[model samples]
Target chain A: MYRSKPWRIFQLSGFGSPEEEGERIRFLLEHGETGFIMEHDRNTGDHLYNVDHPEVMARREDVGLTGATIQSVRDYETVLKGIPIESTYGHPGGGVVQHGPYALACYWTVARRRGIDLGKLPGTGQSDFFLTYLGCVTKQQVPTQTGLRFNADIIEFCAEHMPHWVPVSIAGYNGADTGLNAYQELGAVFANAVEYLDEIQRRGNISIVDAAKGVGGVSFRVGMDLFEDVAKLRAGRKMWAELLAKRYNINDDKAQRLRIHSLTAGSMMMYPQPLNNLVRGTIMALAGVLGGTQSLGVSGYDEALSIPSEHAHQMSLRIQQILQNETNLCAVADPMGGSYFIETLTAQVEEKAWEFFDEIEAHGGFLNTLDSGWLHQVAHKNQFEEQASIDDGSKIIVGLNAFADDVTPFDIDGFKSSSSEWKHALERLNRVKSERSAKLAAEKMRDLEAACRTDTNIMPAMMEAMDAEVTMGEIGDVFRNVFGDWQTPISV
Target chain B: MSALGKKILLAKTGLDGHWRGVSLVEKRLQEAGFLVVMIGMATPDEIVSAAVEQDVDLVGLNVGGHIEVVHKTVDQLNERMVGVPVFAGGAIAPWAKKELEDRHIEVYPPGSSLEDIVDAAFRLCRINVKASTLKIEAQINPKYSADGAKP
Candidate 1:
C-alpha cells in the first residue's frame, strides 16, 4: 500500500520589517501552507549589504521592496517570533552564495536560542549558484571558487550537525527564469550538483551518501510549457539517479532519491493581464504536481506588477489546496507515469540534458562556465530568442499580444510594502550596533574573517558572529576585504 | 541627424541586478542602429554625468525601483542635458506608469514589444525613419556605419 504525501505548499514569503515578514509567514501558514520561505531584502540580503551601504543608500527606496531588511540575529528573532521553528520546514533566505553562511548561521542560532536541537531542525539552506552567479548576479559576491567552497563547507557542516537540514539546494528555477530552456535547466542543475558532490568528495570529510542527499533536494521552475516542463522534471530525477549510481558509485536508495521543489515561473506573469496569471499559475503548478514534485510554490497573480499582496498570496496557497483536495491528485503516484507520449518526451529530455551536461564538462565544469560567462551566454541567447519569438508574434501571450482586451473587475495598484522599511531597518541596525557587546562582536568578526581565509568551516564563526549580534554590512565588509568581489562576467 | 548614428544612454536606476529587461532593450536598440551605451546600475548622479559625457541623443532608464528614483534621474537629466528625451521599461506599476507618462517619459512595462520600444526611441529622438524599417537600410548602406553615423 503506497501512501502519497500531499505536496508541500511552500510559498516564498517576506517584505518590509522583520515583524511584517513574520506576519506574512504566519498568514500563509494559517492559509494551509506546509512550509515557509524567509526572503531577505534583496538590496541588503542578496548583496550582503546593510541599508546604509552606499550602493543601497543610492536607491534606499528599493531596500525592503523585495524582502525584509534582516541585519542581525535580533532581526531573525523578530521574524521568527512565535513561529515554531522546531516543527516548521523553513528556507531562511541566503539564496546568494556569499550570504548562505550568514543566513544559515542566523537561523541555526535562532533555533539554538529557542532551545531547539540543531540536529532536529528541519529546514533548507539556499546558496544556489544559479541565483548568485548566473540568474540574478549581485554587484558584489565572492568568486565562483569561493562560492563552491562555501557550499562544500555548508554540506560538511550540515552532515556533522543538522542531519535533517538540507545544506544547499541547487535552484534551476533561477537559470530557467533567466533563460535556459528545459533541457538546459536540467543539465546545468545536475552540473551544479556535481560541483557540490565532487567538492565534498574531494574534501573527504563527509560520506558521499550524505553529500548526495544534501545536494539532491533541488528546485526547478515549471513554466507555461506544461508537458515539456513535466518531461523535464521526470528527466531530472532519472538523470540524478543515473549520475549518483554511475559516476559516484553510490547505491544508497535514500541518497539516490531526488526530491524536487517546483516553483511556477514568475517571469511568465504578464503585467497587462495580471488577473490571467492565476490561471497560468494553476497550469504551471499542475505541471509541477504531475512531474512528481515533492513541494510547490505558485507565483502570485500580481507577480509581474509587484511582490504578492496578501490576497495574492492567499490565492496562491488556495490554488495548491484546491489541487490537493479537489483534484484528488495525491491518490495516485506519478499520475503522468506509463503514458507513451509522456515517456518518450521524458526520454528525449533526458538525452538532451546529458548532452548539455557533457557540454558543461567540456567547458571545464559548472563553476568555470559561470566564471567564464558561458552559461550566461547560453541563457542570454535563449532569453533573446524567446523575446524575439514573442516580438514577431510567433509566440502569443493571452492578453498581452493577442485578445488584447481588459475585462478585469478590480484595479490592483501593486502591493506597496511599508515605505518606511529603510528607516526601520536603519534604526534597528544602529540599535544592534550600539547595544551589542562591541569587543565580542569584533572578536567574532575576526574569527569569521579568519575562517574565510583558512580551510576551517566558516559556519561556527558565522554562528558566533550571529550570536554576538554582528550586522550584515560588517560581514559584507569582511567578505569584501577578504574574498574580494567576483568580477561579474555578464553586464546585467 | 540620421537614426543610424543616434547615441542612446541606458542605465538601470536601481540596485536590482536582474538585467534581462535592460539587456533586451539594449539588444533591440543596438540592432536598430542606435549606439547603445550601458551604464549598469547607476545612481542619478552617475546617470546624468554619463549621459552628458557620452553626448547621448536619448536617455533610457531601466526603472526597477520606486518612481522617486526615476524622477530623480529625470530631474537631473533635465537640468544637465536639456531637450534629451527619456523613456523607460521594467516593473513600473500602473500608477508609476501614469506618473512617468505624465512627465513625457514613455513607460514600457513588461510585455511591451521590442519593435514598439524601438519605434518610441526613433520618435523620441526626432529621427525621420522608423526603426523597424531602418534596419535593412542601415545594414546595407556603407555610410550608415556606427562611427560614420556619429555627428
Candidate 2:
C-alpha cells in the first residue's frame, strides 16, 4: 500500500465564462484543493463544436452553463491564466474521446507559449470511450477505431514528450454512474484498458510497460454502497496488478501500481433536501479515502438539481478538508485490508469482475460490445432494475424515498449561468478568428486533415493547428470528413 | 383505457446526451399506452415542426441545459402548434422551474416519480378514463405478494 503518498484533493470546476471558471478554480485552490480540473462547455467541448455551430446556436443560452466555452487555445489561456501548471496537477477538460487531442493540444500549446516544459507539467487527460460512446452518446463523433487511434497516439506522444502526464484516463466512473454495477464497472474498465494496451503493442512505438504506466491511472465512482465501493476499489488495484503481471509477462512495480481516482457518484445526490447530500458526499469520499485512492472528487450537494453553485462547491471542499485533517485518514493506506468481511468482499468482487471481463472478451472485446450495444444493454437492464427497486421501496433512499418530508430552510436553488455568457463567448470567438492569420490557420487545418487520413500521429499536427488558432469546430470538421460519425447502437 | 390514439412528441432541448432520464420516461409513457415519438436532441425549429407534422397532443422536453433554450422551444411550439401542452423533466434549478411553471409548462426535476409523470401526461393530453376502466391487468399473475404473502 502506498501510504506515504498523499491523495490529491481534485475537484471539477468550470462554468459561465473563462474568467469566471478561472476565478472558481482559484477559489477551490485557495480552499485547500491540491489539484484542479477545467470543465469545458459540453455544447462545444464534448461535441467539438464552436459557439456558432448550428447545433450550438439553437441552444445559445446553454453555451456556458455546463462549463466554460473554450473554443481555442486563446480560451485555454484565459482559463489557465495564473494557475501554476508546472507545480500543480491539472486535468484540462477532455473527457470526451473525440475532443481529447484538441483539448490536450490547446492546454499544451498555452503552456508552451508560457515557457513551460511539457515534461515537467503533471496532469491527466480523459479520453474515455465509456464517456464518448456509452455514457454520453454524441450525435456525431469519430468511430471507435478512430478514437482508439487517437488515444494510442496520445499515449505514445505523452511517453515521448510529456513524461509527467497521465494520458487517457479510462473513467469507469462514467460507466458505473450510467448503470453498470460494481463488478461490471470493474470488468469493463479493465477491458477498456486492454484495448489501449493492445493498440499500443500493435503500434510498437512505446514499450508496453511505459504504456501501462500511462494507462494505469484510472477513475471509478463511489456511491452510497460504502463497503462495496471500498471493496471495488481495493479489488480494482489487485486486478490491475494481476492483469499486467499475468497477461503481459513483464511488470515493473511502478507500471503495475494502479493509481485510482474516485469521484462521488453524482446520481446518488438527491434533489429534494439537497443539504442531505453533504453527508452522502462525506460518506462516499470516506469510501474513496479508505479504499486508498490517489485522488478524489466529491460530487456537489446540488448535483441532482443543477450544476454546483459556489457555496455547494465550497462545501465539498470543506468535507474533504475535515476528512483529511481530522479523521487521520491519510496516516494509513488500505486501512480495511485486514478486516475479514472486507477481504472476502474484495476477493469476491475481483472474481466476479474477471468473469465479466471474460464475458466481454467472449463478445469480441470491450469496443465490440460498445459497437453492438451489448454493453449498453447490460447497463440499461441494471438501470431499469434499480429504478424498479427504488419505485417499489426495496431500495430506501433516505431523503428521497423513506423520509420524503423536508421542512428545512436551506434555500438551495443551485447555480444558474449568466445570460451574457453566450454573447461574451461569441465576441471572443470572433476576436480570435479576426486576429489570427487566416491563411496559416487554413494550411494547418488541411495538414491536420491529411494527418488524420494517414497512420501518422495526429498530436504534432494537432499542436500546430492549435498554435495556428484553428478552432475546435475546424478540427471536428476534419474528423467528420475523414473518420465520419459513429453509428450509435442505442436510441436515445 | 386505451390512450385513444393520443400521441406525445419528445425531444431533448440541448445537445447534452445523457439519455437515462429520457429513456426511462419514454419506457414508462409507452407502457401507459400513449404513442411516443422520440426525436432526441432536436433543435427548437425541428421540435416545433415535428409536433405540428406529427400532430402530437402534447410535447415532452427532456431538458439538460439552460432553461432559456427550452423556453425558446416552448415559445416556438405555442406559436406554431397552438393548443398543444408541453411538460419537462431533468436537472432543472428552482429558478428555471419557476420560469417554466409560469409559462404553464409543468416542470419535473430529479426525484420526480414516474407514476406522477405518466399521470400528468394523461391529464395534459385530456384522456378521460372512468374508474372502472382505469385498472391495468397484470401481465403475469404472481402466486405470492411482493412481501412474500401468498396471493
Candidate 3:
C-alpha cells in the first residue's frame, strides 16, 4: 500500500522586498505549491554582506533583482511571518556555500523564537558547492576548505538537533548548466558528498548514519537530454545507496535512501519564441517525474528573458500541477526504471559518473578541483565547444538557429523596469543597522571571526550572531578579514 | 607584439563565470589577427576605465547576465568612445538583439558563427575584408543554435 506523495511542488519564490516575497510565497502556496524556498538577494546572501557594504552600495539596484534583501533573522520572521513553519517544507535561502551557516541559523533562530522545537522543524538548507563555485560565482566567498568546514558543521548540527532538516544539499544543476553532461553531474555530486562525510569522520563526533541523512538529499538539473536526464535521476538514487553502503559502511536503509530535487535547466530556456519554453518546461518536468525526483522546480518559460515574470512563474507551477493531476505520474516509483533505453542510459550515466568521480578524485576530490579551478576549466571547455558547434552549423536551437518566425504579438520584455523594490531593500537594510543591538552584535562577530581563524565549527557562533541581530555586511567583513577573496580560477 | 596596434577588450557584465562564450569568441578574434584584452567580469565603469587605460581599438562584451547591465555599459561607452565601436554576444535573446541594434551596437546572439563575429570585429575596427560567398550567406542568414545547446 504505497500512496506515493505527489512530487513536492516547489519553486524558488522571492525577490526585492520582504512583503513582496511574502506575497509571492503565499501566491504559490495558495495556487498549488506545497513547499516554499526563500531566495535571498545574491549581492548580500552570496557574499554574506548587507547592502550598506561598498561593493553592494556601488550597485544598489542589483540587490533585489536576485532575491529579497533579508538582513537579519528578523527579516526571516517577516518573510515567514504567518506561514506555518512547522507544517511547510521550507528552503530558507543560503544558495551560496559561504552563506550557508548564517542562512540556516537565521531560519532556525526564527523557528526557535516561536518556541517551535528545532528537532521537529522540517526544512532544508542549500549551501551548494556547485552553485557557489560553478554557477553564480560570487565576488567574494570563503576558500573551498573553509566552505567545506562550514558545510560539515551544518551537517553535524542538523543531525543532532533538527532531525527532519536537510542541512546541506549540493546542487548538480549548477555544474550541469556550466557544462557537465548527465553522468558528470552525478559523479561530481557524490564526489562532493565524500568531502563532507570524510571531514565528519575525521572529527569522530557524529555517527556516519546521521551524516548520511544530512547529506543524502541532493539536487540535479534535468534538461533536453530527456531520457538521459531522467536516467540520471534514477541512477542518482541507486548510486547514493551504493556509495553510502560501500564507502561509509552505513547499515541503515533510512540513511542510504537518496532524496532528489530537480530544477529544470535554466540554460535550456531559449530566448527567442520564449513561449516555446513552456513546452520545454513541460518536457523537463515530465523527465523529472520519470526520474523519481522527490521534488521539482520547472524553469520559467521566460527564463532567458529575465527572472520569471509572474505569469511565467504561474505557468511553471501549472505545468507541474498538470503532470501531477492529469498525467497520473505519482502512482509509481522510478516510473521509467526498467525500459531498455532508460536502463542503458541509466547504466551509462551511472558508469560515466563514476569515471567522472574518479577524475575528481584524481584531482584530489571535488573541493580540491574547485579550489584549483580544474573543474571550472572542464566546464568551460565544454561550454566553448558547444558554442562552436552552433557557430559551425553542427547544432541547431529552434527559436535561435532555425524556424524563428513567430506569429504571436505578446512581448516578454522580462523584469527590466522594476526598481521600487530595490529602493525599499536599501532602506530596510539601513533601518536594521540602526535598530539592532550594537554591543552584543559586535561581540558575536568577534567570536565568529575567532571561530573562522580556528578550525572550530562556526554555525553555533553564526546562530549567536543572528540571535543578537548581527547584520549581513558585518559577517561579510569578518570573512573578508579571515578568508580573503578566492582568486577565482575561472577566466574566459 | 606589445605595440600591436589592434587590441579588443573582452569582459562579462554578470558574475556568471562560464568562460566558454568569451573564450571561443576570444579564439576567433585572435585568429583573425587581433589581441583580445580579456578583462573577465567588470563593471561598466571598469570597462570604460579599461578602454581608456588600455587604449584599445574596439570593445566586445559577453553579456551573460541581465542585459540591462550590458546596456548600461554600452550607454556609458557611447559618450566615452566616440569612434571606438562596440559589439556584444552571449545568452542574449532575440528581444534584446533589436534594442542593441537600434543603438548601432552590433548584437550577436547564440547562433552567430565565429566568422560573423570575426567579420563584425573587422568591421568595427574598419579593417579590409574579402566579402566572399560564405561571408555573404552568413551575413544574409545566420544559423540557429540547437535546442538546449550552450557554448
Candidate 4:
C-alpha cells in the first residue's frame, strides 16, 4: 500500500494580492510541492464580506494577512493565471461553510472557461464544521442546520457533476489544534462524517456508498506525542471502515479505505525558540508517514509567530522531500505493524475513540453538540487541563514551560504580505460592482436567495451568480436575510 | 486590599476568532479572584469605550492581527483611561513584542505559561498575590482554618 504512491506534498499557502498568491503557488509547485492550496482572506472569505463592508473596513489592515482577497471571479482568474488548473491538484480555499459554494463555483467556472471538463477536475474544497463552528468560529455564519444543508448539497453536486473533486473535507486538524485530545479528535471526526453521510443518505439524491467515498478523504493533526498520534491514525482508519460497514452496510473495498491528509499541529510551534519547531515538524511528519497518510502538510517552523515566510515554506517542503527521498521509509507498508506496543496502543485508542463517539451520539450527534456548545465545553476543559499540566511541570514544552532560557540568535520576523492588499481588493470590488451587468447579477442573487429559502441545492444558482460576477458581500447579504446569523454558543 | 473588586476586561483586537488563549486567561484570572469580562471581538473604539464604562482595573487584548491595530487600541486606551494598565498575548512575533514593550505594554506571546499570565494580571492590576491566594482558599474551602487546622 505504501508503494502504491508517495504521499503528496501539499502546503497551505496564500497571502497578499492575487498575483502575489499566484506567485507563491508557483514557487511551491517549483519547489517539489505536489499540490497547492489557495487560502482566501478569512476576514472577507470566512464572513463572505466584501472588502468594502463595514466590518472589513474597521480592521482593514488585517485584510490580506491571512490569505489573498478573492472577492469575485475576476480575482480568482488573476490568482489562477498561468497555473494550469486542469493539471494541478488544488485546494481553492473555502474552509468555511457559507463560502464553500462560491469558492468551488469560482474555481469550476475558471476551469470551464479554460475548456476543462468538470468531471476531470482534481481538487478539494473544505466547508469544515470543525473550522467554522468549533475551532475558528467566524464572526457571522449560517445556523448549523443551514451549514448542514450546504454540505449535503455539495456532496450530492460532486457525486453527479465532478467525479474527481472532493466536495468537502472534514478536517480534524482544526479541532485538535483548538483543544480536542487524540481520542476526542478521532471520535469527533467520525461523528462529523456520520452527519454528512446520514444527510446524504436522507436526501436520496445519490447513493450512500458514493457519499461515503467523498467523506473518506479526511485530515488529522499530529502533535509532539509521536507514538500516540501514529496510533491514532491507525485506529482512525479502522474505525472508519468499521463504522461504514456496521452503520451503512457498505462492504465495498474502495469505500472502506480512508485517505488521510496529515498536518503537524500548528499550536505546537514555539514562539520563543522558533528554530526548535523544525525538529518538531520533522518528528510530526515522521509520525504521519508511519501512520500511512495519503498526503501531508508540515506546519511552518514559524507557525506560532506568523504565517510562513518563503524560507520557512521552503523548509517545510524540504522536510517532506528529505523523508521521501533520503529516509527510504516508503519501502514498506504498515512498518509499525505486528509490534506489540503499537498494536496494543492502537486498540486502546480505538476503544477510547468509540466511547467518545458514543458519548457524542448520546448527546445528540455532532451538529447539535456544536449548537449547544457541548463540544466547545469539552475542548475548553481540555484546554484548561493542558495548561494546568504545563503549569505544574507535568508537561515540558522545551522552550516554553521547561527550558526557560534562550540565547539571542537569529531573528525571524515572520512574513509580511503586501500592505496595500486591502486597497487593491477594494478597488477591484468597486470595478466589479460597476463593470458587471447589474441586471444579471441581481437576477442571479434573487435566484440564490430563492434557492437558500427552499430545499433545492444552491450550487446551480451560486454558479450562475459567479458567472454574473456577483460580489461576495452581495451573496452574504442574501444569506443574512434568508438564514440570519448563527448564534454562537461560546462567547469568544 | 482584597482582590474581589478587581475587574479585568479581555477583548480580541482582530476579526480573526481564535479563543483558546483568551478562554484560558479568563478562567485563570477568575480563579485568582479577579472579575473577568469578555468583550468577544472589539475595535479600538469599542474597547476604549468598554474599558471606560466597565471601569476595569486592567485591559487584556488577545492580539491576532497587525501590531498597528494593537497600537491603535493602546493609543485609544491611553488617551481615554489614563492609568488603566493593558497587556496582550497571541501570535506576536519578537519584533511585535518589542514594539509593544516599547510602549510599556506587557506581551505574553505563545509559549507563555498561565502562571506568568496570572502573575502579570495581579501585577498590572496592583492586587497583592498573597491576598488573592488566601481569598481563593477561603472560597474553595469555606470552613478551613488559617493556621494549618483541618476543616
Candidate 5:
C-alpha cells in the first residue's frame, strides 16, 4: 500500500435483485475495483414510472432486467447497505437527466443516514444528453430546456454542499458510441457544457467560476481510434480550459483544468467472435488511458448482451488494471502531448468541434437543438450512415465484416437473462404500496408539483417526496403536468 | 399472392428511439410492397390499438430496452389478435433473442443484414420480396451548419 498511485479502475455493474446486484459490486471491489457504479433498471428509472403505471405494468417482468429495481431510498440502502461508499468512489447510476436528481438524492440520503457528511462524499453522476437525446433516446423525457434546468440545479447544489462531488458529468461517450465521430464528440461536449454554464450564470446564485469547475469533469468515449481518441481526450482538457477563460473570464486553476473519465464504446464490441472483444476492450482502454483520462470503464467482452455477467465485469476491471500496472502507462501525465499526428488530430478535433459548437449556438443553443429535434437528426444521420458503411464494407469492422472467422479456444456467450428479476420488482412494488403512508405521499407529490412549477429548486421537494414514500409514477404524473412529454421527431 | 396490400404494423416497444434499424426496414418494407404503418414509440396498449385499428396482418417490434418490456408488448399483440407473426430487433441480448425465438418470434440484432430483414418482411407480408434493395442512406456534408429533422 506504500504506492497508492493507481487510478481507480471502475466498472458499471448491477442487474437482477438488489442483493444479487450488491453482491456483484462487492465482488468487484474485493478483486481490484477502486470504484463502483450502481445501475438502476432503465424501464422504471429512465421513465420515472412505477411498476403499476400502464406502460410498466404491461411488461412488469422487464422491471429489473437492466439493473436492480430501487423505488425508494430504502431500496437504495438495501443495495448499498454493506458497501463502504464513503471510502470508495461511488457512481450512483443517474444517467438520465430527469432520473439523475432522484438517484443522486437517494444515494446522498443513504450516505447521510450512515453518518457520512455530504461534503466528504466523492463521486460523479452522469446526466448525459448524448444518451438521452442521441444514443438511447428515452420514450419520455422533459423538454431539453427542463433538462438543462435540472442539470444546472444539480451543479449549483453540489457547488453549495458537496465540494468533492462532480455534478452531472457531460458524457460525450454516449454520442461517440451512437456514431458521432471524434471531432463531433469534442464539439458537442463543449456546446453542451456551454448550455450548463450559461444556465448557472442566468440563475445568479452560484459563481460562474465554481459552476464551471464543478461541471468541468466530463466523460468521453474512447474506442479503437488510438491516436484520434487520445488526442480527443487531451484536446478536451485544453478546450475546457479555454472555454472557461473565454466565457467566464476566470483563470481559476481548478475551473480551467478539465477532468475526464472514459468508457470504451459498447458498439465497438462485435458479436461475430465474442472473445475478440477482449482485444477490443484492451485497445479501447489503451485509447482512454493514453488520452490522459482521470478514470476509465472498459466495455466487457460480451457487452452487446445483457448487463455484464460477473466474469465479464471482472475481466473489464482486469483489463484496465493490467494497463495501469504492467504497461507503465501512469508513470507520466499527458504523454502523447506532442506527436505530429496526435497534435494535428487534437487541433483538427478542436477546430471542428468549435464549428459544431458555433452551429449549436446559431441554432439557439443545445436545448434548441434537442427541442426542435435537430440534434436527434444529426445523431440519426450519423447512425444510419455508419450502419450503411458497415453493411457495404466501406468502413470495416474487424471480425464483423472483414475477419469473420474465429479460431480462438475460449467460448463466450453474452450474459444470461433472468425472468426472476421482474418477479422481485413486482414483489417490491406491492410491498411499497402497502408499507408507505398514502396521505403523506400525496401531499409530498403535490408539493413537488408546485415546486416544479415555481422557481424553486425541485431537489429539496424531491428529497422530501422520496422520504415520504412517493412512488415514481406519482412523480411522473407531476412531470407530465408541469413539463409535458417531448414530442420526438424520430420514430425510435 | 392474394394478400397484395396487407398492412404491416411496425412500432418501437421501448422508448429507446434508435431509428436506423427500424426506419430503414420501414422504408424497405414499404418499397417492397407492404403497408408500413410506422408508429414511432408506443406502450403495448397503443401498439395493439394501432395494430387492430389498422387491421395489420403482421407486427414488427423495435425493442430498445429490457427484452422483458418488449415481451409484454408481444404478449399483448398475441392476445389482441390471432395468427399475427411478430419480429423484433435492437439490443436483444442472446438470452432475450433466444426467448423471443422460443415464442416463434423472429429476432434480429443490430448487425443483421438488411436483405435478411427485407426477406422476412416479404415472408410476413406474403409478397414476392422484390429485388429492389433500399438505396437511401444518409450522407454527412463536412460543412453542415445545423442538424436537419426528418420523419
Candidate 6:
C-alpha cells in the first residue's frame, strides 16, 4: 500500500540571516530533500516580535539561534529568493498560534508578488496550540478564546481562497515531545480537532467536511518507543476516520483520510555521545515509514545541543534517503497491520485514547484543559515518571545513563548561532520601517487591529497589513492591546 | 529550618519556553526541600532584582539561548549581589559551558542528573553534602546512615 504513495522527505531547515537561510534551504533541496520547512527564530517568530522589540533587544545575541530572523514580507522574500515556492511543499514557519497570521500572510504576499496564484500554492501553516500554549509557551500570547477565533478564521479563509493550503495543522508532536504519552497525544489531538470542527459547524459558513479536510493533515512525534508509536499512527488514522463518521455523520473519503507528518522526537536525542542519536533518528524514521506517514522529518543527531549543524542536517536527509531507496521498507503500506501483537497494541491504544478523549470532554474539552493546567499536569506527571525511570536505572539510555563514557574522535561541539545576526536583523528592520509607506502601513495596521477587536475574520486585514509592510512587532502590539495575553496556567 | 529548606531563585534567560528541562529540575529541587522561586523567562534586570528581593540562598539560571545573554545576566547578578552563588542548566553547549564555568558559575548541561543538581544546590546553600546525603539516607530508613556512615 505504501509503495504507491511515496512519503515526502521534509526537513526543518533555517538559521542565521534570510540569505543564509535561503542558501541552506537550497542546499537541502539540491541534496534530495523533497520539501523544506522554514524555521523562523523562536524569539521573534514564535513571539511575533521584531528585532527591536524590548524582549528581543534584551537578548539580542539570540536573534538567529533557533531559526532565521524574518521580521517582514521583505525578509520572507529574502528567505525564499532562490527557492521555487510554486512547486516545493514549503512550510513557512508559524508554529505558534498568534504568529500564524503574520507568517502565512507574509508567505502568501511573497507568492502573489511573484505573480503566483494563491489558489495553487501548496504549503502548511502550523498555528499549533501545542506549540503556542503548551509545549513552547511564549512570554505572551493571545488568550485561548482569541487563539480559537484566529484559527477558525484561518480555516474559513483557507476554505474560501487557498484551497490547496493545509491551514492550521495541529501538531501533536510538540505535545508529545513536551511529555505527553502516546494515548494522551492521540486524545488531546482529537479533542483539539473536535473543538475546531464544532466551532466551524457553529459558524455555518464553511461545511464541516471542508474544515475536517483542512485540519486532518496533523503531525505526530515518533520516538524510541518504536512499536507503540507505529501503532499510534495506525490507531490515529482509524480514530480520525471513525471520529468524522460518528460525530459529524459525514464521510467523504477525502475528509476521512488522515494525512500524517511525523518528526523524530528531539527530546529523545542524547547530549553525550551525540552520534548515537543517528541510530535513534533512523529507528524513529523507520517507525514513521512503517506506520505509513505521508511525510517525515528526522531529527538531527545534534538536536540535544542546538539546532542542526550543516553536517547534522545533511545526515538527517541521508538517513531518510537510505530508507527510501535502499531498505525497501516503504514497499508495503501498514506492513505490520495483521501482526497479532501490532493489532492488539493498536486496538489498546485506540481504546485508551477514546477514554482520554472522554476525560477531556468531562473536563470541559481541550481549551479548558489547557486553560486550567490540566493538560500540563498530565504531561508533567509523565515527564517526571520517565525521568525517574532514567534516574533509577529502570530506563537505560546508552551513552547517557548506562554506557556513560566515550572517547570518540568526532569533534561534535554543536552549532553556534552567528553573533552578527542581531546587528544585521536590526538594520533590516530599520530599513523596512524607513522604506515603507508609513501612512499606509499605519492605516493598514489600524485596520488589522479593528478586525481583531471585532468578530470579523482577521485574515484579509492581516494580508493587507503584510502588503503595507507592517513589521511583526507592530502586529504583536495590536494583538497584545486588543486581545490581551494568555495567563499561562503552569509556572514554567 | 531544615538543611534542605534554603530558598533558591530560578529564572530562564531566554524567551524560548520549553519548560520540561527546568520544570523537572525545579520539581526535583522542591522535592529535596528547596524553596524554589521560579521566575519564568525574565529579563536580566528582572532576574537581578528578583535575586536581591527574594534574598534566596542560591540562584539557578535556565539558559536556552546565546551564552552572551546568560553571561550578561550572571555578570549583573554578581556585580549587584557579590557573594550569591549561581548554577545553570539547559541546552548549553561545550564552549558556552566552559565560559560559564570560567566565571565561577556551576554549569549543568543537558543529561546532568537531578541528583547532581540537588547536590550542587546543597553545596551552594552552604549545607554539608555529606550531612545532606546522610539525612536522605536516614529519611529512607532510620537504621541506615544514623551515625553519618557512608552507605
lDDT of 6 by residue, A225-323 (tens): 999999999999999999999999978999999999999999999999999999999999999998999999999999988889999999999999999
Worst 10 residues of 5 chain A by lDDT: A1-10
TM-score of each model, paired residue for residue: 0.96, 0.96, 0.91, 0.96, 0.92, 0.96
- TM-score computed on alpha carbons, candidate 6: 0.96
For candidate 3, the docking band is incorrect
Predictions in order: chain A TM-score: 0.99, 0.99, 0.96, 0.98, 0.96, 0.99
Residue A384 in model 6: shift from native, Å?
Answer: 0.6
Kindly provide the TM-score of model 5 when superposed on the true structure, using C-alpha atoms: 0.92
Model 3: residues >4 Å from true position, as ranges?
Answer: A420-422, B1-5, B14-24, B62-79, B89-100, B109-116, B129-151
Best by DockQ: 5
Candidate 1, residue A43: the lDDT equals 75
- Judged by whole-model lDDT over C-alpha atoms, candidate 5 comes out at 0.79
Runs in model 5 with CA error above 4 Å?
Answer: A1-4, A407-411, A437-439, B1-7, B15-20, B27-35, B43-45, B65-83, B95-99, B102-104, B129-151
Candidate 5 backbone collisions, by pair: A139-B15, A173-A221, A492-B17
lDDT of 3 by residue, A136-182 (tens): 67667888877888888899988888899999988999899888888
Q: Each model's DockQ? A: 0.35, 0.34, 0.21, 0.35, 0.42, 0.33
Q: Candidate 3, DockQ to 2 decimals?
A: 0.21
Error of 6 at A486 (Å): 0.6
Question: What lDDT tens digits, residue by residue, belong to model 2 across residues B46-139?
Answer: 9999999999999999999988888888888878888899999999988889989998999988877666788888889887653233443222
lDDT of 5 at A439: 90
Error of 2 at A264 (Å): 0.3
Per-residue C-alpha lDDT of model 3 across residues B28-140, encoded as one tens digit per residue:
56655677788876778999889988888999988755567767777787778767788888766556677788888898765466778878877788877632223222110
lDDT of 2 at A369: 85
Backbone clashes in model 1, listed as residue pairs: none
How high is the lDDT of residue A157 in model 6?
95
